[model samples]
Target: MRAAVFVFKRFCGSSFRLQNRGVCDVAVVGGGIVGLSSARELIIRHPNLSFTLLEKENELALHQSGHNSGVIHSGIYYTPGSLKAQLCVKGASLAYKYCDDKGIPYKRCGKLIVAVEREEISRLKALYERGLQNNVKDLSLIDARGIREREPYCRGIMALDSPYTGIVDWCLVALTYAKDFQNAGGSIVTGFEASDISMATESPAGEPEGLKYPVIIRNTKGEEVRCRYVLTCGGLYSDRLSAISGCSTEPRIVPFRGDYLVLKPEKSYLIKGNIYPVPDPRFPFLGVHFTPRIDGSVWLGPNAVLAFKREGYNLFDFNAKDFTDALLFRGLQKLVLKNLLYGISEMYRGVFLGAQVKILQKYIPELGRSDIMRGPSGVRAQALDSGGNLVDDFVFDGGVGELGGRVLHVRNAPSPAATSSLAIAEMIADELEVRFNL
Candidate 1:
């Protein structure tokens, strides 16, 4: 395509309709942080290869990536040698570096997980030990006096200081990545939903076994395209996409709505950086925390409650089909039965504004029920196994000479996911190299 044509079409937001648009070597099915980061890495690693990223929305980062807490995790909560730990540490540095080079705003404001009473002390100590194992730098155990020094208003008896933890504008980061990808000869097809994917026929004669078939992709607008490989990084719809690709994983995505409260402008400075509660060992999400956003606003939140729709962001956003599907899913039934007590409590808090205010008061005693307001909410895409258990770690399943050998499916890319984007992309690239001779 000519430079003039590219410029004119991009300006018109009709770049995908260009008649001479190039074919793709790789087709990424999602435009969130993971897919875009993967697209950027693939292009950077092999500039000669053509690539395209498809998003259902008119703009990128419209979902999880856009609504995240803006915290750059410190790698202190994950187990050692795990993908979450490795990627978080490495990707945090890369995220900061990219933000610096692009002149995007970010801060190394630090985080704390506080223990309010005697019963929580054991969990607090365990978190400190885990931080050490994860190689988190400058982590310390702080008593009440020390905690007061870090956060004067916090009401904790003991705390775990994670200095490496900080905040960044993730949506800004995603926007920056989109710009970088396009500048480096990559195509992003927004408002183009990936409706279907199918394997191509094997070539005749001496064609290499690895590059036998391309993954055929059809967009929502009824346009069909093909690529030598497919990388599924659909955030909320990841498992569903895998099911469509002929994988029998059967992980039904259960949306958990995490709501927040942006403190009134005057009360914003009540907590300096990020102040967290030591997490429940059984739960995957970090308990409610105070996070300072890049725009200098302090917010509290992220209570996990079942959502009626996969992308439902509001209390009134509901789909009968989605609700019935989740209700009938045997796995969800098992999961609920196993954690009935906690599930009930979370639902109670979800309805009562006072219950949520109590969770906040543990960390910030000055916060009153009247000081809270409905902050923007985000939906978490949680996956459940056939037996009704939440998949807690990164899970990938593929092998040589398989049904979808080279096409690696991303089943669950959860929290710390944005923080781990670049590292995960590198790992995916490495896997392709080994499995398909990329």
Candidate 2:
């Protein structure tokens, strides 16, 4: 065990190469797509500035960015004037351009929002209008025949077609971003878990107080790095990391596990593109849907259930602290009470394969329990407010108190986050440039 521990420490130490006197212009916490993109954007905009990116895991995109459904959303479901709608619409184009420039493979396969029942058609129409309002191009409301033309096996009274929707391997995209950041002279240090952030008072002689490096970040290994500014894109632990930097904790992260079912090889042909249901507006989570991955397999489901741990991917995975945090939160309690039926139904589908197949059969009448095998799962970092309302849009909170004007935190960025990563990075960079005169 001692030998193993020694080897582990040596390996991690080699990756970081931390210097006792090392400093940077910026330190980005979190190595997900957003962090990588942010780092890339910073280096591109300010060619001479230095940056350090910290990640707890040895590799990047092992969490939400890796586990997502890989759907390039077309700005359909978000509120018209919200950040999600704006960023997602812009991000889709940016993502495609990035993919083309990087030679990353992607497809503009289009998507169908199917309304199987009469009640859903009205809601579907409302969504179509919302999409139009959000400036989603090539969006059209279609009848049953139109749905047939788009997705032959999909059963629906009506549907909305988004031709701009597409798919790409997001993990690959994130890796490419990491490579670009490194190529631009930004340092990426994995296995460095940022434990606390404090203000650094020391400044170089004759430096203005406002220009001094004010943020000190300490990792679990007791290593310290000082920076003039900090941007945290911590996905699952955003709240904790923000609070460590003297930011408000009114909205806390709650982990929700979304499990998918991969169709059998023969059954993969059932979905040509993406098929989705009209989502409940009260919550941000889109309902169970059919997604065709770039790898030529169809994925169904992603039923949302409270996860016992932030990174829990298996059914029985548990963590006492994570479980207790969700259970004891007043916001979770209120959210559960308000959406009791929906929550119970989602949990049911999570547990029973038949229940999930039933939901999928609403769109693909041919799907049976035997047609699918258990596939991968991802945990969403859902943010809930103290008042029990689930945050429904992209949320960014700049630090306050001691860390004021020096730190920025992304409190909630789920679903379309991977798609909006580059555009989101641009927004963060713009904010930092204006605030710090970068």
Candidate 3:
């Protein structure tokens, strides 16, 4: 039955045609949280606008949105005045409100960023200051005693407590967004894999005279959809999708696989809430940390390692095209060289059980090898530029080639993206409003 459904969906996705069916005001690609949220935002702002959302997969949130740690970031780690900071801080409140209104389950359990070494205290202080500057409310600098009070088994010289940090089932949140979008007269099509985008030489009738191009979106199954405008929230394949739409190729998406270890049920009591390490300033990834899920499970040690495939969740998973892309990218070569030692350590932890446990022991000394088994893993789409620098903030690009102003692409959205989906959608919607003169 599953095989039949998969085959039928694939056939429909490839053969489906919307060219004669009707024209839509807008089309949204990617059915993750961001895409759904963007569609919902568009509907809310312009209730009568005709819009459709396309998901390549059979269901929504099957990728990054569903595989995350479910931690609701408090915007403490991002730099002040950056898009991440602004969106995350606002997005958390919006997320909570939406969840409450929708009757979705979530937890307001706070988080702790622990500094085990004396040298980390200064860095911790800096993070605290940044959090304050970002207007992260209820943030406090805590000493070792305070850490114990909040998380008894955790040990550190000092820590930063973010009471606003919480957790939720992001997949559920995304589904709710989809429901609201549908309620507002938006259409969602699953299994529609967008393969390329091109501009129509002439604008469709009734479109403004100045609107030079109506966008044509083609999917893998030879189906096509014509719309006045398109928005892409293509998480892992964002860069490729943008390139297909005639956007620049300077910043490419690099996949990093984050593998976690779940604590044995009997030992889950050793930690409460989220416990994190003071992140290394040089890199964007937050190191391995402990996260308590809404399902009452505690997860640890999601060390980032280069993934051979963009969606490769398993260590052995490989794709010839994805692997060659990463290997041929000059930026990735330089990035690996610069972080050689750190990359080696992460790889080692992934292979060796003891190495992974040792890193976790820095915070919870009682955690041993037997206390944790393998847990779920996720792949992050880290965008890298030609200079080998990681793109630290949200990247949105459009208005290029002959399709200028007819398309918008979300090129880079990583961690906190799930947390900031709604806010990001609003930002994208605002940009579209001005660009398209809607």
Ranking by lDDT: 3, 2, 1
Model 3 per-residue lDDT tens digits across residues 1-438: 011122211211222222123357899999899999999999999987889888888777888998899988889988899999999999999999998998888999999999999998899999999999999989999888999999999999999999899999998888778778877888777777999898876665676864433678888877777788999999999999998877888689999999999999999899888999999887657798999999899999799999988889999999999999999999999999889989998999998979999989999999999999999899999999977899988888995776777888989886799999989999999988988787
TM-score of each: 0.91, 0.92, 0.93
**Preferred candidate (lDDT higher): 1 or 3:** 3
Candidate 1 lDDT, 237-323, residue by residue in tens: 887678767776467788888988778778876879899888887864677778888887878787888889888999889999778
* Candidate 2: tens digits of C-alpha lDDT, residues 271-368: 89899988867654788999899989888888999999999999899999999999999999998998888899898888789999988899999988
The deviation in Å at residue 438 for candidate 2 is: 1.1
Predictions: Cα RMSD each: 4.0, 4.1, 4.4
**Model 2 residue 352 lDDT score:** 88
The parts of candidate 2 lying over 4 Å away from their true place are: 1-21, 201-212, 282-284
Task: Report the number of clashing residue pairs per model.
Answer: 0, 0, 1
**Pairs clashing within candidate 1:** none
